[model samples]
Target chain A: MSPTGNRADWADDEDFDDPSVLPPQEVITNKDGTKTVISYRYNDDNKKVKVTRRIKTTVVREHVNPQVAERRKWEKFGLEKGHAAGPSFDTTSVGENIIFRPSVNWKANAKEAEKEGGEKGSMKDQLKDKKVKCRICSGEHFTARCPFKDTMAPVEEGTAAAPGVEAEEDAGGLGAGKSSYVPPHMRKGGAGGGEKMGGRFEKDDLATLRVTNVSELAEENELRDLFERFGRVTRVFLARDRETQRAKGFAFISYADRGDAALACEKVDGFGYRHLILRVEFAKRTT
Target chain B: MRPILLSGHERSLTQIKFNSDGDLLFSVSKDKIVCAWWSANGERLGTYNGHQGAVWTVDVSPNTILLATGSADNTVRLWNVKTGECVKVWEFSTAVKRVSFSPDGNRLLAVTEKRMGFNGTIAVLDISYGENLSAQAAEPTLTIVCEESKATVAGWSFLSKYIIAGHEDGSVSQYDPKSGDQLENVQIHEFDSQITDIQFAPDRLSFITASKDKSAKLLSSRNLAILKTYISDTPLNTASVTPKKEFVILGGGQAAMDVTTTSARQGKFEARFYHKVFEDECGRVRGHFGPLNTIDVHPAGTAYASGGEDGYVRVHHFDKSYFDFMYEVEREQARK
Candidate 1:
């Protein structure tokens, strides 16, 4: 059967033959020609949790039969999810607003649940056995004078808190993040960091960089020969245009050591390429 | 590979949960449907429909067939996993932000985000009485209220001993559900602006915190001490640590990593690919709008999935370097 109560095409041969086990839907019929509706449900295992059927039937409403006409109107009114009129069953006598068909629920009481969970169950379960609670906080264990709040370190003069810990930053106060550039914006923020140079990168450190261009240093053969002279050039970049693949103007060269970088910069700085002086320099330091 | 998109679009997807037992995937969407998919293979098993507004978050119980979803309609709907039907609905006032089931499935932690200029508190719902097909199992269930300013994030540990909560005050409090006493409550990580995510590490006592401070902080869940710090060039958008190794974190932001393009021969265009999401290869990638947004390393740590503002969550599996494999292959070719 389909999840939405429809049968799947692949499950064509699957049969739900036993109507005796079907969960029923509630229905109401009046003295006149109208009917009410109700619903029921079950899992794949076919255990019916609710049982009421709205098996529709119709009655005749005529000019002579005024009582039947009024009953039909009431029945139709009950068909609505919440209607004021319905059949003659006294709901007040039932003692409950709704009634449910019963099933086997294993844990009927705290005692039963507690038994299922032996002595070593969990701290939450253990505390409930005894009615001991923190009178001040009115909570489980720790009180208003919780020991952690009162750490052993002696107080200092000019700090809201002791060293190494500042205070919590209220995130909800900051409000939701809004940026036009990105629609779905969710960021990860650090907590409990009191240090001034905190966050991710410190003030002395750099945070952003951009590659302006990537151009060829030489023709393929000559470039190969020059790079082979070094211990090993794992990566070489001849920057190119984003739309067009032609060289942009410069590239990055990675070598095994700083010595290789210095050698390449010294030797290839002014080397003639297509009779044009190639520009080469050690990459500048970043923030 | 094409991911199986939910039937309805336009509505945003709020949260995703995996039922490891059946390897089924459950997703709550704004469309008000809880979709279940086979985890081992992507097959749409069922669609659970209920709730008036967007279904915001979905969580799975450990070993049982229970699925809970919170919606913007201000209600929590619990579903019987085997059947695509809602078994119960837990009502709330404001919108429910996060919903977590205790590891034992006997307790359901529903954290309703309180929004006001200067107030925050959480409402706890006990699931011991809220189990199975029997309404006859109604015992005295109580709603515990913990007074605070604002809770930005909330969850229960896998063990369910404590309710881990993050407040707008930049503080994290672990409270006992039964007694409602605040056990270990402190500002785990403080940021200049906001905390984007607070995660409990699998080991329990240790956890990771990410923030707009352009950094991620790892701390001890017991005392909430700073364990190690990971700095990013740009503010981190999303951060998640792997299940095995705590150090291996999967994250993506606008960190502009070093860009390098191979030489384009006479006519060949250089494949100038920008590094969007990367670990510390050479140096950390830096900047938002510079590279990546969402990233998830595989549980095995050998591969990863990254989704960026660029609009794709790509899966990358690491392969041994072909150059290393070909070293001997080249010698054999020379022998011939």
Candidate 2:
């Protein structure tokens, strides 16, 4: 009745004959010119009708070409046999000279050379007393076969005059080495002595801050947020005990802007954060 | 009075603004979604999609038919409000931080940061109907290069002729949108602090600026002269003057980066109110548990809304008792 093809459309079917309200039926024709009729009706609950229809159909045999059919059957049988699609290469042949040989050292060992000098005295003292230093660079090697003759080795403070011992006999300027390499920490104006907390500040470390009197409950993100208002904070490091894995009551906050770091240092210094009085300062650069 | 808290954003909210009719509220955040809500009932309407990065600023057209948003994805997007369809996209070389629609809704002004640290280029684009609708790619009508410092906030005047921007160096610059000429550049603060917000007053004759230096200043719109300074104990992230010019509300707190669950529950966030003329503290309202990043006064002057780093928007309406007290205060002042 609602146009959904439900049974409500046939409520008054008695007044007029409606084809929709008629019993569901089907007709089947047999090849022998005989017919069979089947009919069913749906109840109010719309349960499917139990009536069944059966019709026998004729099967037509298809003609096949023997040559094509044989080829297709063979192809299917080959695929079903699980054969590889490509030719396999032979790998059973043994190659020539595949045995691994350990390298033998032809040069004399330093320890053996020292032992050859003598067993009565200390090896280093015996080597020094025997004057077995390299003739080219005053090292412990022969002058003609010295390995460091071409390389640059700075002259140490105590070894400055050692090069003059063989200046005339050795290779030109080989004994007069360049100045000794000095590490940044030992160099002038290095950051070794000015370490802030446990970290060093570099030229670009203007935004880094050293905060003291930090509470153990202070988190890295909390320290970062505390200084973030000054500028964009790039990192926050809370000093912690290695074994205990607990805060060490101090932290470092790094900002992207030097001005922001300086501002945070000035404004947040001596400020109260939680139950602690924060002492904030600029971190010093250390090498 | 109790405030209605709307919580949806997962991260810090960047901005919130009401439509011209004050019926719809649009909010953007670092969560990369632009959400719309019914202002009166606080019911979520829908979200604007298609942005691949954090949306920093949002503005509704004067006609309330379109919305413009700027995002860190280096794009300026325009959306059809009713259909939630992205109508157009304008690409930039850097992240767009702030965006504003003109009074006529025919043009858009945006501040695009060059890379990360301060320094951005101000672009004024004509967004009206043009010949080519083929995802129209049009150059900005005017480009003002901010060389000294990156501007953090920007706004277009009511007349749509002047562009005002605040920089990280606590300086304000006024530019002509037509010729790209800089009309005025003034350093308003002595400490050279980062300018967090800049907005034109409802009167359109003055403007307000908030800075990380723990202060907010009201300046004359014409010559950029300070008329009043509202000082706060903590850093002020945002400030707004009432529509009737009766009160100034400043919102701020301890840095959001430091807010732990314990500290937040202690109620550190607040919005402090001050008398406009006397600059005296009137009262303070506490609700948010995190730093307030943005505050916008209702056009009707009876209510105001704030978005905070705690990912909530709290809309506070003035109570009747406060209105009565303010009336009495005004009457006593008039007798003098």
Point to the candidate with the largest TM-score: 2
- Candidate 2, residues B1-336, lDDT tens digits: the string is 556666657788899988766666788899888877655556555678889999999998876767899999999998876656688899998999999987787888899986766458998888764433325447888888898887888887758767888898899888888898889999997547888888777756787888988889988877788899988767888888888547788888778465455421353477777777666666667667688888988777767888998888877666665555554566798789
Candidate 1 residue spans exceeding 4 A from truth: A1-287, B1-9, B116-119, B128-131, B134-147, B245-247, B250-336
Query: CAPRI verdict on model 2?
Result: incorrect
Predicted candidate 1 versus true structure: per-residue lDDT over B60-121, tens digit per residue: 77654677788778787777766655777776777776677766777776667565432344
TM-score of chain B of each: 0.69, 0.91
The residue-by-residue lDDT of candidate 2 on A1-287, one tens digit each, is 23335547566556357544645566878677656667676768976464655655567996544542342222111111242322112201111221111111201242356457565467676667576654333445675565543321221221334334333323333334354554434444333332431232243456678788998878888887788888998777776655677676777777878888889999999999879999998875322
TM-score of chain A of 2: 0.31
Lowest-lDDT window of 10 residues in candidate 2 chain B?
B259-268
